[model samples]
Target: MALLYIIIIVAFIDTFSQLPIIAPFAISLGATPMLVGIIIGLYSFSNIIGNIVSGYWIDRSGPKIVLCVGMIFVGIVLFFYSIVTTPQQLVYVRFFHGLAGGLIVPAAFTYLGSRKTSESKGRIMAFSGASVGIAAIAGPALGAIISGRFGYDYLFFMLTVLMIGCAVLAIFFVKELQVISSKAASPQITSLKLTKPMLFSYTSIFLLMFTLGILTFALPLKVEELQLSAELTGPLLSVFGLVAILIFVLPTNVLFDKWNNVHLMTIGLVIICGALVSLSLSASFIHLLLAMMIYGGGFAFIFPSTSATVVEHSGEAKRGKAFGLFYACFSFGVITGSFFAGALAVSPSFLFLIGALCLLLIVILLYLFSWKPVI
Candidate 1:
């Protein structure tokens, strides 16, 4: 479990490290605003492929080996990123990096879900969620400092080390379980199967993450448009991440335990809609901060609820595939959101309004389907 926390932190840090440096890095590389958007969007484009393939492999081979390979792959990619001089080269690196990142979430979640009980599942997942929060809180600040002082190469080097460390931990500490078929299961093991409930859970994750990607791309541009200093942007983003973690690890989990997962998800979507509306009106730091807090809180609730639902709905044999599909949805949403936001860059306000409308559409779908809570 401790090892899992290490892996989570490393993954979170590696993934977010570029957030603080992206704009400045792009400027240094002579990328225009549109080009910068493309560079950022490209990472998500790669993630779509990685999530599906990695999920399938983990389901077939177990998470331990898949995780190890993913960590190693990311580490090598980070090293390569240090040398990227063109937008095209950076795009290629980000695409492969996203593919590597696609493996980590499902593999980790599937491993946790495959355990014997939901109570333990919740505990481990809470810890994993907290680790992500901590990383989100710390990563951008660290990246900003490193980039401001030693430049992008040093930041990438630091990420490479963290990725390598994650690989080492996985190799030494992660224990692999034998892949057992339903027919060969011991009496203590319950046979599980994938169902429609699992598909809905994955759909929920995909929709939420898709909106999140759009927000990520749009928010930075909005901040820049407001003429805020580059340093201020990192701290502002950290505020959102911090609020998200705090809400996710405690209040949101309690809510999940007390309420139906479907109901909680609906409420979360509503909150996101409100946040987007608020973001559209935001013209200052305070307004952005308020909007982000609400947005982050919504994200906090939706993420774990959706994940827990996937676990609850899937059978033991198909847990890996379910999680893999879940992650695939998440990655695909991100890719779609990024690409869509980039293409629609002419009006950030309109983009946010569209996101809100999409959430409303999702809420209507959920209501119409009368989706039952998985947990």
Candidate 2:
């Protein structure tokens, strides 16, 4: 459990550590606003590719090995980030970083979700979720402080050390579970049955992550455009992370245990739509705060519900493949959201409205699907 927590924290840190630095880094490289968007968007694009491939690898190799390799890759790539002097070079690094990240998370979640009992599964996942939340809150602050004090080079060095530490911890402490051999083995571990529930869960994950990508990519840029200090951006993001942690750690599980996963997920989707609408209209700090709260709540509710449902419907032997597919959906959505939102951000008002429209479309789709019985 301790090792798992370490891995989750490292993954979260790796994912978010760049948020506060991206704008400044791009400007230093002589990038225009659109180029900055491309750098950020490219990370998600590469992440999707990595998630699909790594998901398959996880099913074949098991979580422990894949996770360790992922950590090593992240550590090495991040060390190179500080030295890159061109936007194109940064884009390349971000792509590979996303690929490494793709390996770590889905494998970790697959291992946790495949535990013997649902109750235990929920608890483990909740803890993992909380770890991510804490990292989201802390990583930006750490990045801002490091960047402000020593520069981006030193920040990358620190992250490299942290990633190496996570790798060492995983190697020393995480126990690898043996794959169950069965008649199902003939099809290969990477092959799994896809059912209606799995498809629905994938859709939910895609939409959920889509919303997150929009917020993560757009909000930071918005802050920079307003010339806000990194210190202020760090705290705002921390507040967003804290709210998400609260929702993920508390009410989400109760609702999941007491009600259907579908119901919980549907409600989460509705909340996300509302949050996006709020974001579209936000013109001040207070408005952004309220939007973040709503966005965070929606995120907290949807992630665990979707994850738990995927685990519920998957067989033990196919759990890794199932989760890989799930993560693929998630990464793909994030990639799509970042790319589209980045393109749209040339005009802030248009960008927010487009994001809101996308969420509204998702809400309608959720309702349409809900009206039909789950197969």
Weakest lDDT window of 10 consecutive positions for candidate 2: 182-191
The number of residue pairs in model 2 that clash at the backbone is: 0
TM-score of 1: 0.87
Residue 73 Cα positional deviation in candidate 1, in Å, after optimal superposition: 1.8
Looking at model 2, the pairs that clash are none
The 0-to-1 C-alpha lDDT of every candidate, in the order given, reads: 0.76, 0.76
Please give each candidate's TM-score.
Answer: 0.87, 0.86
Runs with alpha carbons beyond 4 Å of true place in candidate 1: 22-38, 84-91, 117-120, 182-196, 224-231, 372-375
lDDT of 1 by residue, 1-375 (tens): 667777878887887778768777877878888888777766766776777777678756888888889889989998997898887787788788888887777787777777664464444555566787788888877887898899889999989988888898789888896675646765334344445455556677777777877887888777878887656666666776788777766644666666676766777778889998888889898998899888877777677677778777776666777777777787778777777787774767778988888878877886556555556
After TM-score superposition, what is the CA distance of residue 354 in candidate 2 from its true location, in Å? 4.3
- Tens digits of lDDT, candidate 2, 1-375: 667777788788877778778789988998888888788767777777777777677666777888889899999999889789898888889889888887888878877876554465555666677788888888777887889999999989988999989889888888887775546465544246665556667898898778777776677766666566644555666776788788667755566566677776777888877877776677777777787788778777777778888777776567766776787787788877766776663655557667777777876776676567756
